[model samples]
Target: MTKDLYARHRSVLPDWLALYYEDPLEITHGEGRHVWDSAGNKYLDFFGGILTTMTAHALPEVTKAVSEQAGRIIHSSTLYLNRPMVELAERIAHVSGIPDARVFFTTSGTEANDTALLLATAHRRSNTILAMRNSYHGRSFSSVGITGNRGWSPTSLSPLQTLYVHGGVRTRGPYAHLDDRDFIDACVADLLDLLGHTRPPAALIAEPVQGVGGFTSPPDGLYAAFREVLHERGILWIADEVQTGWGRTGDHFWGWQAHGRSGPPDIVTFAKGIGNGMSVGGVIARAEIMNCLDANSISTFGGTQVTMAAGLANLNHLLEHDLQGNARRVGGLLIERLRAVAAQVPHVREVRGRGLMIGVELTRPGTDEAAPEVASAVLEEARAGGLLVGKGGGHSTSVLRIAPPMSLTVAEAEEGAAILERALRSI
Candidate 1:
């Protein structure tokens, strides 16, 4: 029956959809950081389901909240008030430390980002958006329009007014090997030039850490300086924290906080960890930016009750357990171990990133080209040794990204890194 179902679905699904299964493992259930295949084989989750399960799978509190809320209500219209929705928004605003943040929830990160992109344009009445090269924002037309990668858009480029690229180098910092001051100056100059060439920019969108762009970390004070430029030009700084936020980075509650900005972003997007594994996403914009909203901007089923319940429970779990601190301590240990492993393995080119959101880059001998195949081999070997990993790179599949749940223990991280080292050795 399962095989028949898969065959029927494959017949109708688009080729470009990129289904993961040639002979897919039918996953039936998950708990904590472990998932069980239909055959009962369990996999220790290191990738955290693409960094979405911050609290791990089937969290007790989160599940209870969902079950309880399901009995009372599942969804409601935006025209009416719901308790969970109100509470979740309030919690997010308080934790974010963004004064007077007005949130609009959506069912997925892409939709949340879609609203943010439109909000930026509406508030500034401008079309040009400054973005980073190799950044992955979302898959929607406008979100993909601002994103710098061809992979996100198989379709032709959208005719937006302006698109600028920055930061695609091997060295540390946003612009690769540039000091914070020089990188900030160059990026600011680029933004000014783009603004002068086109009309004023609607927004300057960026991730706190570039997730899909090989886990790029911006230069320190980069966002602050860029924010100043955008503020001067009456443009919004849209911090796309889809992958970097929700305490996955470890040190900060949100990715923007790690950047050391004096004021929060004019707009910020959150998903993934917002509701554990549920499809809940949202944009938190300042009251000033949200003032631009009109009748047409509202979503029909964005902030449903079920999503709010899940979000609230996830936030509670994060706070009660102090998962952010765990992320910091455990992730630090993991990074140090990964660096040590890199030193031992010639193929492991570099180990970088903050807290739990770490990456080990690989490259072949004599060539600057990334050895993504080597990275893939490492992944397979790690899986053989009982671990799962995610891959990323611009040149090759050079990056082995380690974005485990905040719930991952220090001992678990050590075990995972040890397995990784063993895998590299086997290769």
Candidate 2:
């Protein structure tokens, strides 16, 4: 059935679409932190739809709003304003700590990012966009041009001006001992120098904790310092919180907030968790930048009625249930457990990330060459054990990307970690 479905869609879908990563499992439905395949096989979704669906799947409130809105109206296009869209925009701006920040919605994370790039380029009226090496923005031409990873940059990459720099925080000594203030300072210094010298960039796009690019968490002072430099140079600081937004980091409402920013980004883009599996994304910018988008800006399917309802409900549930608090508590427990497991397993290179957005990088038996094959083996083994994980990073390193729903339970976290430990032992 899966093969037939793929075959039927192959003709219309672009040949470049990488559908092979998905196995033959026909996912029927999902709830909370688990999903079931067509054959009634249950799999714990540690991947959380690649870090989206933070609150969980088929959430009661979100589903109710989606279904109700679907009956009333599914879409009216950007030409007309809908209540759900309006309310969602208001709520997003409110939580973002940027009052009256205008929003431009899109149908997906890639679309949101693509729109952000266009807005930044046009607003700044400059050519250069600075991005971190090994970062995964989106596949759209403008975004792919700025994405530093070569893996995603094929012939389709846009011929636009851009600069790339090393991203992610580096750690030394022992996994048992974190809080390496000195190392953090050095990383900050190097980054500041790079950005300072490469001034005049239209915008510096970054992820709070480098997602796909190994889930690297930069030094504590990196983002704020970088923002200061950008402000001094009049460069826009674009925070691509597509993967890290919506309280997944636990301590804050958005990953940028986790960076200790008093105010949010000059422009902030989000997608995944806003709709909790439905297609929706948005860019929230300061009024200063928004005023610049007076005309000649639009998105065809931005924040459709149904999607906006879903996003609004998801955000509401997140706030009411204090999912951010859960994320912090559960995420801390999960991180500690992962570090414990890594200590036992020599193959585990580093366990890095914040909140529930975690990645476990694996090295060779004794080398720096990212053992992607080993990572693949671990992933396959975990799947066979009924746990679904995700992959990321430059060489697609052995980073078991475990971004389960923020509703993930302590018991689920332990079970998932155990399964992962078993998979690592086998690998």
Candidate 3:
């Protein structure tokens, strides 16, 4: 049955749409932290559908909200007043930290980011944009234009004139050998040099933690320093928080808070977990930027009642239970455990990340060469051992990405870590 389905999927889906493992598993059902694939195999879900499942599988509050909203009204175009949408927007605006914030909903992170780009360009009257090297915004044409990772970015014909910046990855680059303070200074100097060569950009867009770039990040306050420069030139700072938002980073509610010395970003884009599996994405910006468009614009399905209901419920659950705190505690222990395990593995290059968004980079034993094959082997072995994880890196997917739900338990973390240890050993 699985083989037949696989054949059908390959025939129907685009070849570029990648799947996991030697044999991809079709997950049929889930509960809490576990999911069942076809043929009745159960695995502990670590990746959470690319970290979209924030709280848990089949969370009762979100389920109830969705079901109730669907029964009442699933969708209505932006022509009418949407109570759920308004409520969710109000909550988001309050938490966004931007003064006089305005929220615009979309269907995915790509759309949210595209909207942000539109606002920034229109408001600042420039198509030039600055993005960090190894950063990924989304997959849409506009979003892809700003992406700096070569593997994910397919073309150079972009609507925006994009300049790739430094300091997204601190492990391997021209300044990797420098200490944290020196590295920050070098990146700042490089930014100043880059700014001299180009027209003033509309915005400098970045992810607080580069998600698809193997969860890599610069030292704390790097962005704050960059913000100072950008602010001086009246350039907008946009934080792409698709994977790092909603307390997944543990210590902060938003990933941008790590660089809080510069205050809030001019714009913030978020998706992936806000609706707890419902398709909800949005951008938050101050009124001056958000209201820059002369003509009206709307997303037909953006703020549908059902998705808004789910978003509201999910946000309530996250805050009520303090899932962010849970992420910090459990994720802290999980990373420590994995670090211990990685120390014994020959190919493990580095272990890094905050809260549940951890990464284990693989390299050739005793060498700096990226070992993508070793990462793949570890992924397959971990699946066989009843664990599911993810892989991503600028160096051909050479890093193991471990992002469990924010509601992860300590025991579950221990279990996942043990399975990962065995998988690393097998590799």
**What are the TM-scores, per candidate, against the unseen true structure?**
0.93, 0.92, 0.99
Q: Please write out the lDDT profile of model 2 over residues 132-209, one tens digit for every residue.
A: 766788877778888776777774447567877543545422221345465545545665677667546788888887
Model 3, 176: alpha-carbon shift in Å? 0.8
Once model 3 is optimally superposed onto the true structure by TM-score, how far is the C-alpha of residue 324 displaced, in angstroms?
Answer: 0.6
Best by lDDT: 3
Per-residue lDDT of 148 in model 1: 69
Candidate 1, residue 286: the lDDT equals 82
Local accuracy of candidate 1 as per-residue lDDT tens digits, 1-427: 5587577867998767653323444568888877776667777777887888888889988898889988998877677888888999898888776668898888788888888888898888877888876777788877778776666656656756547656434364356566767877777787677677777778878888878767867666777877887777788888888888877787787788865565788899988878888888998988988778776555567778887888899888888898888888999999999888788777877788887899888888555567877887787777767787788765545788888888998778888888988988876
Best by the TM-score measure: 3
Give me the displacement of residue 335 in model 1, in angstroms.
Answer: 0.7
lDDT of 2 at 281: 87
Q: Which stretches of candidate 2 lie over 4 Å from their true place?
A: 3-15, 20-23, 156-159, 171-199
Please, what is the whole-model Cα lDDT of each candidate in the order they appear? Answer: 0.78, 0.79, 0.95
Quality of model 3 by C-alpha lDDT: 0.95
Task: Name the runs in model 1 displaced over 4 angstroms.
Answer: 1-9, 19-23, 168-175
Worst 10 residues of 2 by lDDT: 169-178
